[model samples]
Structures are given as C-alpha cells and as structure tokens.
Target: MGKEQEKEVILEQMEERAVEEISTHDAEKSIEEKLVAVQEEIAGYQDKMLRAAAEFDNYKKRMERDRNAAMKYAGEHILREILPVVDNLERALNQGVVSGVDAEMKLAALLEGVQLTLKSLLAVLEKFEVKAIESVGLPFDPNIQEALVMEPSDVVPASHVLGEFEKGYYYKDRLLRVAKVIVSSGKAAS
Candidate 1:
C-alpha cells in the first residue's frame, strides 16, 4: 500500500529469479561436459577395433604366401640329387671314345666306369626310399612279377621264378615297377 513497501517487494522477487537462472545455466554446462567425455571414449574404442581387424587380415595373407612357396619348391631337392648322376653317365660315355687307347683296355675302363655310375645311382635311389625287389630263386608272384614265358627247369620248381629280364622296384613300401620274368612250368620230358 505504501510506495516504499511496494518497491521493496519488487526487488525481492527480481533477486529470486536471478538465483534460479544461474542454477539452471550451471546444470546445463555440467550435462554438456559429461556428453563430450562419453563421445571421446566411444571414438577411442572404434580406433582400436579397426587396428585389430587390419592386423588379422595381414596375418592371413602372409600365411597363404608361405604355403604357395612351399608347394612350388617341393621337388627341388630331389632334382638336385639326380643331376650328379646324369653328369657321371656323360663322363663314362666320353671316356669310352678316347683316341690311342687299345680296344680291350678301352672296353675294361668303360665297363668299370658304367658299374661305378650304376652304384652311385642306386645309392641316390636308396636315399629317397627306393629299393630293388629280388625275384630270382623265389616263388613267382603275379602281383609283383610279369611272366614273359613259361619254361621247363629241374633247378627251379614249378610256379617259381626262373630268371628276371628286368628287375622290379619299390618306392616307399609301394611297388614302382613289376619284374619281367620267366616262370618255370615243370621238369622237362625225357
């Protein structure tokens, strides 16, 4: 009712409104700061996931390349071993044709060279798990021996191997070649 009282009442109401506005602004600022922190944490996790995926892809490609290289060179070692055998054979043939050597002496030297070369080849084969099969004086086996002819013999019993035209061979427990052989029929008629 009085002018001074009315003025005091208006000042108190304005002060209360200012206090409410300041409190609301502070609450809004705190919420904004929390949202920024959460967004940064999410970005860091995404970066780590991307890096892990790239590393896994690189590992798979490297393994595939190594496997292909291994397959390509699988038989390189075996071919290297056989090259020396071929060289030895070439030398033996060349020695057989040397001029001024006596015919008998040349023949003996050639034969010796061939025998040595054969021994060396056999050694190489053995190193790779290849072995010769013995057929002479044993019972004829159709599984491993091919009968070239039937012959009558007193020394070899019926159904036995008379002789081998070509020897059989085994490579790692499996038959590589069959023996070409003569099989005994029975004793000859008097």
Candidate 2:
C-alpha cells in the first residue's frame, strides 16, 4: 500500500523475530540444565548400585570362609575324646606283655581294662547324644530295628523283639544305625 506503512510493518516483524529468538535461546538453556541434572542423578544411582553389588560379593566371600572353617574342624571334639580311649587300649596291651605276669592274671587285667575303656567310650557317646535303642522285650520297630531272624519264643509275644544281634543307635534325634534283632513268632502250637 503506502511506503510508510510498509516500513512500519517490516520493523514490527524484525522485533517479533528478535523476541522469538531470545525466548527460544532461554528455553534451550533451561533444557540443557535439566538434562545435565538428570545425568548427574543417573550417575549417583549407578554408584550406589555398584557399592551394593560389591557389598554382596564381600558377604558371600565371608560366609564361604566361615563354612570352610567349620568343615575343617567339624569332628575335632569327637577325635579328642577318642584319643583318650586309644591311650587306654595301648596301656592295656602293654600291661599284657609285662614280664613275669601270669597268663590268667594278665588276661583278667586286660579284660577289665577293656571293660573300663568301653564304659568310658559309652559315656562319651552319651554326652554327644548318641544313644542305644532298646530292642529286647520291646515291640519290633522297622524304623529303628532290623529283623535278622524270626524265632519262636515262649517269653516274647509275636511281633516282639526277643534278642538283639547288634545294637541300634541314635545320634542326637537322628537314626545312626538300625538294631539287628530277632523277632518272636510266638510260642509253638500245642
């Protein structure tokens, strides 16, 4: 239209572009700051995760070392107890070989020594919670007793244990060995 109006319109357009550029620059700066903050947060979280993973690895290693230590010395106490019994047996045998001792007297002494050693061994077993299962005169239990033979007995009733061949044993509430026993088949028919 008119020259004056055209110039005014061009100046207004230029001002608007300048204002738009400034606003766009401010928005870009804000976005860059937020992106940097998010990156820093991610890095912090990664560091924490790495630390936690390392801690777990250390825990596993500690437990493995403790388990190995336990396994290595697991039976130390029992072996220590058995050592005394071994010493007693050695002494008994040495006594049997002594000079000028009569054969019957030496034999009796040897037997007595062995009996005492056995009693000591039993006491040790009991201290460790090892127990003998009573099989004689009791009802036969398949869980703890193993029947080796069926015998006819006048004293023991049918399905009852008459005699034990080998004693059964328990170790602390767990069955260690089954008792070998003879089960009665009741009295003979008249």
Best by TM-score: 2
lDDT of each: 0.92, 0.94
lDDT of 1 by residue, 41-129 (tens): 89999999999999999999999899999899988988999888899988888888999999898888889888989999999999999
User: lDDT, candidate 1, residue 136?
Assistant: 89
Candidate 2 residue pairs in clash (backbone atoms < 3 Å)? none
Question: What's the number of clashes in each of the models?
Answer: 0, 0
Q: How far is 147's C-alpha from truth in model 2 (Å)?
A: 1.8
TM-score result, candidate 1: 0.68
- TM, every model: 0.68, 0.79
lDDT of 2 at 100: 98
Flag regions of model 2 displaced more than 4 Å.
1-19, 188-190
TM-score of 2: 0.79
